[model samples]
Target: MSTPLEANQVEAIQGYDAEKRYKYLVKEVVANREIWILTDEHGCVMLNTDYEDCVPVWPNKEFAESWATGEWEDCKAESISLNKWHSRWTHGLEDDELAVVIFPNQDEDGLVVYPDELDFELKQQARKQNQR
Candidate 1:
């Protein structure tokens, strides 16, 4: 069954173009520190942030918001343009250590990497990972 939208959420999202959609970043926090990568209902990982794409697009606001509420209640969602996503992803990131911290992803081990590294290659890796 499709989850019903909460009144406040519905109100907050009112006036949005139902026909228009944009990409959103959804995050899940673990242990109060580590941020885990979250996938959308389609199983695509939400790695785009305000720093990366110029026009990241989603199918619709409801599809984007589904991760923040409803069945995906544990995730947090943020709408982002493609440009913003890339911009924030690399902004203020210097050391490899800071890179990871600014942008984190799921690690091979259950324990997530905090203050993790975001080398240029990581972005490519994430995009490829999302395809899977």
Candidate 2:
């Protein structure tokens, strides 16, 4: 209920500080629509919609390792982009069912979330799922 900078604030700040101080950005998911970037105050930046840039990767030793190390570029160019990957993985899952799944990783906790097609194929099955 106080003063709130509109969308132009971000562009204004950017223009004002193009080569000056860089503000630290804290990105958080909120209300399924608004994106809040916090630093020292509220409404420093606001986005009305969601944004994601994720790349699909298989949850296996050979595949996950290759993706982490950038070895599968030649084979799966489309799936390597973060936008494509995130879209492919959570395509058919319900909103609540789209929770992140972490599998065991040789280096650490699992970091790969793959598409359902690769999932079924890797499981030695032949089922296809579609996005809604």
Candidate 3:
């Protein structure tokens, strides 16, 4: 059973979700207030926001699992890309938790947002090779 406080916290996290995706919560995932730049075992790169539920590359389920299992770190990829629809966000998840927030790319299509820069650049290099 959820205490009043807990219920309020979940409610706060589900703020104004007309689409019901990304929301803020009193329950925070990231133990640190700072952004952590992290690289997964596969070496993919991405910009991670605060410690909350981190957003990792989907389809790459292994990498996502790593972050959830405490095998990764948080780093804010603050490049600031905008979108036409504010409802849709490119959120990375941590464990089974919903994304507390997301990177600024805000695009649900394509590469979405890299959780770290170094890995992203490296993966891009691989993508280029595979394409050719």
Task: State the lDDT of candidate 1 residue by residue for 1-132, as single tens digits.
Answer: 123457775444443333211111121111111122334556424333333312112223443454355555665444334344346533533332231222221211111122223223344445555677
Best by lDDT: 1
- Measured over all alpha carbons after superposition, the RMSD of each candidate to the real structure, in angstroms, is 15.4, 19.3, 16.7
Candidate 2's TM-score reads 0.20
Superior by TM-score: candidate 1 or candidate 3: 1
lDDT of each: 0.33, 0.27, 0.29
Query: Over all chains combined, what TM-score does candidate 3 have?
Result: 0.19
Give the per-residue lDDT of model 2 (tens digit) for 1-132.
Answer: 112335564334324321121111101011111111111123111112133222332222232333333332334211123233335434643342332223222333323233453333322321111211
Q: Which regions in candidate 1 have their CA more than 4 angstroms from the true location?
A: 1-64, 70-77, 92-119, 122-132
